[model samples]
Target chain A: MSDTSFDSQTREASFGDYFALLKPRVMSLVVFTALVGLLVAPGSVHPVEGFAAILFIALGGGASGALNMWWDADIDRIMKRTQSRPIPSGKVGAEEALALGLALSGISVIMLALASNIVAGALLAFTIFFYVVIYSMWLKRSTPQNIVIGGAAGAFPPMIGWAVATGGVSIESIMMFALVFFWTPPHFWALALFMKSDYSEAKVPMLTVTHGRKVTRQQIFGYTLLLAGLAIGTGFTSLGGPVYWAAAVVLNLLFIKGAWTILRRDEEVAEADNYAAEKSFFKLSLLYLFLHFGAILADAVLMRMGVTFGGLL
Target chain B: MTFRPDHELHKRRKGRNIGVGLVLVGFVALVFLLTVVKVERGGSLQGFDHTQRIDMVPQGSNK
Candidate 1:
């Protein structure tokens, strides 16, 4: 071996550096949604298998994040919001990140198969491939609809969780999938509204960058309508109850209002980054998804409590 | 600045190599322990044993 202290000096190390590599922030959402899926699905998965499945799902999500970082390091470094990520900051080498990502991806998928079922494992494999290959490698730079298409990768967790329980897909599981899928465009475009410069500087074809803000705003409203319809529609499924329906109605109304506010704002107001509307919408979107899932959870609890609303009028 | 200090570099690299090797061994050992526990427990450590009576239909009503 040759002295690598010189190389070490060229790099840096810290606890935060490693945490950044794992994409902890993104992992939190992955863990949350996956847990909701597991909880709401009818029937039982052994507690051990359930926990293990979720753990592997989270690891798989992190693997995708790491691979995304490795591939997008160039744009990441230029983007203000993403500048301090581990690989771009020289805290971790791109090669190390890639190796860690691939290894984790393999482990997560294989372990999920062993812990749960093949259907869930297959979904996990496809999720990793879709995000790392389709979204990160292709759509991200090549098209303005990157987030819209890449959103499918994020939407798979609940369906995978459903598969773990029911051993297959169904209308209910796919509805959960569609909720996330349709919600992604507007949720992401809202951020794009405020962070317009970052995408432009990074040369990433975010909707706000590739198209004008007016067009982006219009699409946001359009998707919000679509998302609300799907969300409300889920109330009619076996998975839904009165609580879920009420929650969906309230959240969708607020979400549409937020989108409308942004659509109506002018350059001066928007550029001042009156994130008042954009920021609120962004935060509300997070709460909206969580609440929708929470409603499902509440419905499950209600059913278990003998509080069925199907015949209450 | 034309001096070659390859020997010192090699020694330092050897030290790093040992440290990294130990870390990797530790990680593998940890994972092995976790895998054993997971498999023995039938794939999950947390058992879903809580009883919750599910109401398939509304009370006093038939579907």
Candidate 2:
């Protein structure tokens, strides 16, 4: 698609269209993980400071999303899943998206520095740069390992949140980062399996598109095993309690089983069922992160209430 | 052709410009207020104390 395709519009853009440019779904995950990171850290933050920290972190995440949309407008136009996005749909121009993204990025980073500490603001700035420059601009088109490496950009939020509270990084924050980093591969590969044609059509080198279904399934299974180990191992850290351990065990079991199911299916059966297993795994992956983070938040609250547990064996 | 001041598209664009300006102004004001609150609460804006230090001497001693 040509850039001119987005130049013609029959109506004015609505507020919702501008909001969509921020990729609210991704921003929500960033906010939740960052909140968990902040809440679970060792120190306490004042209520207003905590609120401001989260707000700035969210803005930073939204800024990255807008920048991603701006750069990926061409591939996004080709992909069925992203064709209705503001830039591609003639609701917002690419230059407008770029300006909004840059403006938000500057405001979010500077304000976060003022509201929290320099470490956190710097991390947020690096996260935005990593996502926009490294992942979106360079990696996504260049490599099938894009999501694997690109996952770090998304994984930084909780660490940023942890920094917001403690003004530094800790093992707990690193574990939180690792949790998301490991979870990202299997989570996105499942979506790739279901949307293989979209990636191929966009000429974006998703693992499924480049390596074929068998290799992709194997990779998913391999990453899931590693992710399961990390998820369960995280339960023994200071960040975890009985609640988190139990949630980890159950969620990992389900996630492993989902990966196993996908691995067992051949392309013929997968096609016949319209990739139901992959879709189901994708949905479960969403819940897997939410539940794990929820468990951590619960553990933090319990600890504050004087409830404690010995590390799970 | 005669000059026109109130074309619908022009009016809508003006409204949007004002709305965006107001939002930016509101954000600046909020940040200013937060900074004031932080200073009032004894939080250092520069991450360290900026007050001048003074030396003390014994009551009967002269330096």
Best by TM-score: 2
Off by over 4 Å in 2: A1-12, A309-313, B1-22, B43-49, B52-63
Residue B10 of model 1: what lDDT?
54
Q: List model 1 lDDT by residue over B1-63, tens digit each.
A: 597756544554566567667756964664565566655654322345533224533466543
TM-score of each: 0.81, 0.87
CA lDDT of every candidate: 0.83, 0.88
Residue pairs in steric clash, candidate 2? none
lDDT of 1 by residue, A1-313 (tens): 3356566454544444544676888888788778878878888877767887898898899899999999999999898888878887777889888998999999999988877789999999999999999999999998999999999999999999888887888899999999999999999988877765677777778788778888999999999999999998999998778889889989999999998897898668866855678888998999998899889988988887787886556
What fraction of the genuine interface contacts, i.e. the true contacts, does candidate 1 reproduce? 0.03
For model 2, what is the error of residue A278's alpha carbon versus the real structure, in angstroms, after optimal superposition?
1.5
- lDDT by residue (A165-249, candidate 2, tens digit) is 9999988899999999999999998997887567788889988778888999999999999999988878878987888988999
- Best-fitting candidate, scored by DockQ: 2
Error of 2 at A195 (Å): 2.5
